[model samples]
Target: MRPAIIRKPAEQSVTPNWDDSAAARAAFSWQAQAGELCGLPGGGLNLAYEAVDRHAQGRRRQHVALRLLDRNGGRCDISYARLSSLSNRFANVLKGLGVQPGERLFVLCGRGLELYLGVLGGLKLGCVVCPLFSAFGPEPIETRLRIGEGSVLLTSEALYRRKVAGIRERLPQLRQVLLYEDNGGAVDTPPGTLSLAQLLAEASDDFAITPTTADTPALLHFTSGTTGTPKGALHVHGAALTHLVTGKYALDLHPDDIYWCSADPGWVTGTSYGILAPLLLGVTSVVDSGEFDAERWYSILETQGVSVWYTAPTAIRMLMKAGAELARRHRFPRLRFIASVGEPLNPEAVWWGQDVLGLPIHDNWWQTETGGIMLANTLAMPIKPGSMGKPLPGVEAAIVSRDEQGGLILLGDETVGELALKQPWPALFRGYLGQEERYRRCFVGDWYLSGDLARRDADGYYWFVGRSDDVIKSAGHLIGPFEVESALLEHPAVAEAAVIGLPDALLGETVKAFVSLKSGIEPSAALHDELLGHGRKRLGAAVAPKALAFLPDLPRTRSGKLMRRLLKARELGLPEGDTSTLENPR
Candidate 1:
């Protein structure tokens, strides 16, 4: 297929904050941009100071920093100044509890004002903060807490009782457990827990930001392994620099923009973009404390006047399943750009946004290890459907293959190989927690080998192939599962699909597809044959699925990523290892 570009109109062209496209050809300097981000006067760089206190103390004090939409149809606004005061009080509470700097603090709660307060306060106090998915099971939560060596836990009474109570004995290093009422109201603590509300009330409302260098460890995010326990990726406060730059260039956040990043704060995207990026840009961020509802999301976008939306492809697919007529009921005059992460956005979803919502969805790529967006379809650039666009400024990306002697050989354009990046990015994770040898395996000399297989086009745009392990080698040809899955999704009946390579006797491997049909679509022999034929016609017979199976629902992570490895395991009746991160384990 030829490259399809969605160009920006004259009137719709946005003035990007970092509009120097020529910078890509120059020697990018991290210090030049690092100097732009506000740091503490004397010395050191603090994430909290740049995110909240600076805006609070400056002219934007009265600006609406956070607009909270409650589950029961209530709205509350928090200004930068008020947020500063509240986070300061929370920091004082931590100080009064004798929690020292560099100690790990874990938060387990749903989307609410308290989660933001806890995170910002922990950063202000210079503690390594880790947010756990509130929906996680007890064992998963316990494993993270134990591995991170968390000393203090801030959670609600309900969550603590349900998920943490049984495993509390196992976490002996966890010295303090602060419990808050789930409804954002004051409540008495249980026998072993302390009341967070009471402590906040007793503590002072003013506290100075901790003096910390850029290298100070600020966040700990755990990435689930395919077989073993999750690996903790440690990131530092300097990552704020990446967040700031990406927010401006990739997200195109303006000062008056109303941004909504519909990712949970527990994930890296949720923390970096959902909370920190918008705050760092001094924009109004909409924080919805409700679950995913098609009507509710439309209403929020229309009523809140969302200008820039950062969400997942899973949500977009759900919206597509609901039909475009449902979206016609709402009007979004203020909405400009819609961006997606978590997984690759299929070309159909990108066109669906332009056809239904009057905008093309811009897809970006990054990982938990990268800490921020590495490649993105910037607002200023033309949108290439199904492409990850180009690398951000100051990011040097290449496609390289490994030689027999473990040396990296740079591949030319249109050649599929490992996607590698030049090292020492501001947002790169310092190391995998307590696994020095494992961290060493991620790098090859000056390049960090991203485990993804991709191809760079002649125009500098990068296209995602598949995970290195997920690529299929059949009949001496390599086939990317994404291309097959995307072609399947182009069919009207297929709402979701996962492609995997199954072992074959004649060929090395054969492509197999697991598909979930859209609503009102029924499974039948005729329909199955029709889908198989559709796949054969769209993707060539050589790359098309050799077999097709219909599933009620595909397994996904909490962050809305398909578990292809799980699909392959179930098909072969192999042992399903590490099912902790699965949203729906079958």
Candidate 2:
């Protein structure tokens, strides 16, 4: 089948923030975007002020900033004014506790008012805010805190008792442990922890933000490697520009749009788009405090009246597995634009969104290191189902392979190579914490090597191949697992697929795929051969999978990326390093 092109010229009525792609790229500048944010009172830039304080002090003061939903069908709305005041009080609380500027303040909590206030307040106080997922076990939590040298921690009372209490003595640098109030009501505070509610209540909400420059270390997000300790990616306050610009151009966020980014702040997507971008754009963002249920998600879209939604491919696949009949049960008339990240979305999921949900799901590409969206199938552009659309305005991406002298040899259109970004982009990570040499290896001269394999078409659309390390070298042919996986996904029986290369006598690496079937589809000899033959027919003999196996589910990271390396390691009796981020590893 020829690649599907989804163009929704009449999909939306409102004029997008960017309409003319060519003109937007030609007339874009980071300096011009700087003027969009309201900096501090004097001569400095602060993310918190731009995201909440500026709006609270202006006409959108009473506008809903965060619409928080609890697991048990509860709703709470916090206006910008309320957000600013509460964050101000928390900032004062941080100040009173002697947490100074540039100090690392780690937040470990779930979706609620405290998570929002903790991040914004830490930014307001000029501290480098680092947020950890509340679902993380104690070891991963302790590792990040120790690596980042966390001085203050804000978490829930239950989370503290469960995950943090055991690791408290292990982290001497964590001097201040703050516990926030949860919906379950107050419990006795731990011995070393302070109650965030009591602290906020006593603290004054009239604190002023100290002046800070654009280079001020504002946020720290830890990214773990497959075989080592997690590396902290340090981002500055200036990264807010990337978030703002990408939200406008890539996500098409407008002030009146009710947006929902179904990602947790533990991952970069949740922090960048879910929190900063939407807030900086002055849009009402919905935060759901429950785990992913297909029915609940559809309900949220309908009831919340969400206009813009940014989610992940894993979530989309799960929804696809839930069947279209369940989707038709709910209506999402308000949903105008939908985008997916965290992985290369399979084309089937994109078409499923169009056929069932009334809109095609746009796919975008970026990484933890890049910090913001580099490529996207934007609202104004025609969606090439599996393509990562085109480069964002002001972003220059190239397909390049390394030369013998360790220099970049730029490849032409339709050539698969490492995706390189010519940078000076605001959202690029400044450095990996305590790993300067490792950080330096990520770039060659001016281009940041993304380690992702991709091909650029003549029309400037980018299609993801696979990770450089994950690419299979089989019989002198370099094959991308994504292509094989995508082809497998087109089959009616396949729900999810992960392709890997295994050692073989004839070929250096042979393609092997592990798959999960749709609901009520069982794995048998006949079905297995049919799927294998389907891959061979679609992808051809050389690129197709020679071996196939059925799995109950595919393994993925906590952030929803398929962990192909883990699958390979388990299959080959290799060490499965750092299974902490794996979701319920066997």
Candidate 3:
């Protein structure tokens, strides 16, 4: 409802990576970005070599690459030379176990020194590294391991006994299990499992990184759909360039700045930005192994002198609910830039940052399939609430509809259509592992259909509608759940909301919403009536939810996205398919 808030550089005159968008795009090329990273000692490219060895052999050898804080309130800093030596030890350990190049290796531990070393080490050995969420149940873990044909697993002794031991028999391809002490060596090692610490102790600290080209597979990230098997999004070593480019432009990382990305390594954002990007830039990356706590987070930003912070909207909303007064308790003078990903942040959150934190949260858009950021509201650009800003310099985006003849028809500004990208970007996922037919359906030709509906405004800002499957058709009106959810979030009492379409014989489908109130607010009939009236006022009657209900909390994925499809399935009593990824399936 308000005009776009034009951002002004502060009194100190903060300079961004690039000020001009058009000129930057014209000058951008994948070749030049790749040239930024020193390739292997020979002529090929390896992610670990570029991210670790290059920095280790250069002036940043003594500079802290990872500033780690464990859950038990312990602190440690690993420099580039230290990281290189440790990762080389890990690579030698893997080689001793006969883990071959191109073989799939899974890292299934919490955020710590081992998780970081395992990923970089696997890449150095030319093994395809996949990081699984530490909080995942046994089924999800087993599914990913089986689908990915995991050859080796790097985990903690406790996790190995509790989560992986029961499912290890199901995976014949998983020949080796390397375990470490996640909780300060409190748990004893189980039989048939090798100790990672002992292996590292026996292995040499120097090893040559395996020769790899740009197309050599380095990362395999699994993304689950609403139904069916999970898709393994495979990425090559060349994606480091995209990570480097996006990190500088979207996140605005500086050499002297201490950057923290709160996402876990289980996700793509964590691997690309949390690990490779920061290391590629030779910046110190702060890794917190602890869970989310508002006071703890505020303390980190203040004490660590974090200049750039990237996190998810779910954590941001929780911090917002804790109230701005709590944030005022700790001052973050060095926290210059903050950005959010994983969800389309509501307009209210964008304004909250400006009002409370003295800076607007720039929201960037990308997916697990894309491997890196595609569109973003850069620091130099004006803040448009709830809009995914212009495309990355080397990326091209469009809204298009398929014609009857199976050709693509590009739409004009303000017209909603399936979001598509002109492909062949460095980080573009090469395949979906085993599902060739399913991967083929995602593209008509060169345009990779995103399966989400969106519209581009005259100012080149793209607004998220809803996923193609999640869009609601009610009384001849196309309704995007995001619009209704955003409106409901504007209310003070509402903490979270999820919208879906339910069956209606008369109207075809009707808009319905489920809301979770703020911390102490209980469900009440009067409050329900008030929320319905508020929705009607914000969005006209036709687009507003015809029915509304209060829930303790809505279902969400580990990445903090609402599971709208699951909500609809429960409403209709249809078979809830593939509920493996739900944070609260109960």
Q: How far is candidate 3 from the true structure (C-alpha RMSD, Å)?
A: 1.2
> lDDT by residue for model 3 over 1-586, one digit each (tens)?
7567677766223689867467777988888877698888778999999889999998999999999997766789999999999999999999998899999999998989999999999999999999999998899999999999998999998888889999888888889999998765644667667888888999999998999998999999988546777889999999988998999999989888899999989988889999999999999999999999999999899988999999998999989989889999989888888899988998888898888988788898999999999999988888799998888788899999999999999999999999999989988899998889988888988999999899999989899999999999998988999999999999889988999999799999999999989888888999999999999999999999989999987888887788999888898898888888777886
- Candidates in descending lDDT order: 1, 2, 3
Cα lDDT, all candidates? 0.91, 0.91, 0.90
Runs with alpha carbons beyond 4 Å of true place in candidate 3? 11-13
In candidate 2, which residue pairs get closer than 3 Å at backbone N, Cα or C atoms, i.e. clash?
none
Q: What lDDT score goes with residue 424 in model 1?
A: 84
lDDT of 2 by residue, 1-586 (tens): 5466556556576887877456667888889988898778897899999999999999999999999999999999999999999999999999999999999999898988889989999999999999888899999999899999999999998899889999899999989988876875665787988888888889998878978888989999987546688889999998989999999999999889999999999788999998999999999999999999999999999999999999999999999999999999998888999999999998888889888898889999998889899999988877888898899988999999998999999999999999999988988999999999999999999999998999999989999999989999999999999999999999999999999999999999999999999999999999999999999999899999999999998888888888999999999999888877877577
TM-score of each: 0.98, 0.99, 0.98
The lDDT of model 2 is 0.91
lDDT of 2 at 387: 90
User: Clash number for every model?
Assistant: 0, 0, 0
Worst 10 residues of 1 by lDDT: 2-11
